[model samples]
Target: MQLSSTTSGKAGSNPMGEGAPIVYVVDDDISVREALEALIRESGWQPRVFGSAQEFLSHSRTATPSCLVLDVSLPDLNGLDLQQQLASTRNDMPIIFITGYGDVPMTVRAMKAGAIEFLTKPFGDEALLDTIRDAIQRSTTALGQEAELQLLQKRYASLSTREREVMALVVTGLMNKQVGGKLGISEITVKAHRGQVMRKMGATSLADLVNIAAKLGSSCGN
Candidate 1:
């Protein structure tokens, strides 16, 4: 299974396509980690192997957009514990679990906890590769969305108080004169604020500004 980069710089496009998605392989067994790393590299992904869960967690926070291939049983904290820790911190990294002695209930629990795949020991290479590809795709989509939302939030944060008020009124279908009247300001002042809002928000058009404002308003409500 060959994986290709599919990154785009658009607002909602994945940023991991410029290179192979980094795959973090966490396992206690040296052989298992080495084999998985070799397989990942052969499949066109960059692999980083960790001897245990603690080792993997010590890496600096990354925005490179990747997935994890973890062993269910580890020397220190188990894979499930690691998964819980990541989820608690709102990290959306996809995980694929490999276990030598997984039970039905354990598999169900892993799936319920948002694992992308669970493979028993001695699984075929094709199956493992397929699951990894799917997990990487999902992680890419999630990271892209997160990046876009952060960009939107940053743009919104750059607005002045009066500029934000003008933006809200303008997007809600108010004319400059009406907005000025509502805010007890001159129409010229409103025009100036609107221009500032547009420039700061990097809006290409009134409709784009309106869409962004609408998204912000809805998110705030939620």
Candidate 2:
């Protein structure tokens, strides 16, 4: 189930590119959804409310700065189940679970699954708002990092196979002659390939290139 009002509305769209934050509410109770929507809107955020976990899943989400205000118990899929499902995807939206029947074990499980908060019902409004603000900040930072990593991946992918080998040995503190010996190539050819790697990666210095190589290697399981 989904609230008809929210289903037809946009939540995270910032048409002007001004970086607006979105709050997604998934709860079985209509009153809870409306209350969260009112609070989020009053705080200058865009809120989209859903009456069940499955309804929220059906909605398309973006890589924008956003967080989920989820109820632990839903009519369709439960909050924890939805979290597990999202774990298999690339979704990085911060989650804050609200439940009237919260327990220590449930809180631990949710936190272990990367939920920002697990608040019991009848919680203070100020507390929830503070957590939401923090969650948004984290989401923004996470999205920025994701974008940076993607750009680095693209840059790394532009390198030729020889250039990649050159980068690997160069970052290991190997001299050009040593790299050439390892690859059974001339020292002059090694220098040329090193220069190409630096140029393609937009690295200004050997140290910078080494750092970039380290980042790509760690991410690529090298």
Candidate 3:
């Protein structure tokens, strides 16, 4: 059988749009895939179904909030293997595993690997739907944090060498005079660099700068 990605949603809606949340269903069973596609579409999510792990992996990924409804047993790579791969590469995407032969150790492994939920086959529709909802919420939060970090890094990169030095010392509770002494510069020059750092980093106050520094993992001694 031909394996490809198919999106399920309203007729005119673009499921791959930036704001639309996508749910991926990777199950070898055609009946299961069909059922999930209908369910996800009805719940106002875009459903992308694939017949195997490889097919799903080959599909291009979008940055929007998403969760995977993955079957534990697939034709190419098993669900556990797929989970391990995604854990390293796409940690922002939450996973909910569905399996017919789920056992204690299998469920434990999946959960320990950061899977949001594991459901044995014959699970209720509401239970799976609720888990998907929670997983998407987590994905949304992770994506937001990742975007924020990228913006912070961009802003930090725009700093001059001296401004970076000043910021590093300022966040370490050093006075402007002390920073100037460390850098062998005048206090007025240090203050100027500090103001530039604040303006470029969009920090409103010293405390705010410190917080941003912490988030950026700015090395104090650098």
Candidate 3 clashing pairs, residues 3+ apart or interchain? none
Q: Which parts of model 3 have CA positions greater than 4 angstroms off?
A: 1-18, 218-222
Q: Report the C-alpha lDDT of model 1 over 67-161, residue by residue, as the tens digit.
A: 89889999999998888888865355789999998999998988899897999998888999898888888888888878877888888888878
List the global CA lDDT of all models.
Answer: 0.78, 0.81, 0.85
State residue 2's C-alpha deviation in candidate 3, in Å. 26
Could you tell me which 10 consecutive residues in candidate 3 have the lowest summed lDDT? Answer: 1-10
Candidate 2 wrong stretches, greater than 4 Å: 1-18, 218-222
Q: Of the candidates numbered 1 and 2, which has the greater TM-score value?
A: 2
Residue pairs with backbone atoms closer than 3 Å in model 1 (clashes): 6-17, 7-17
lDDT of each residue in 180-217, candidate 3, tens digit only: 99999999999999999999999999999999999898
Q: How many backbone clashes does candidate 2 have?
A: 0
Model 2 CA lDDT for position 114 = 92
Tens-digit lDDT track for model 2 on 131-157? 999999998888887787788899888
TM-scores for all candidates: the values are 0.78, 0.88, 0.91
Full candidate order by TM-score, most accurate first: 3, 2, 1
Q: Cα deviation in Å at residue 146, candidate 1?
A: 3.0
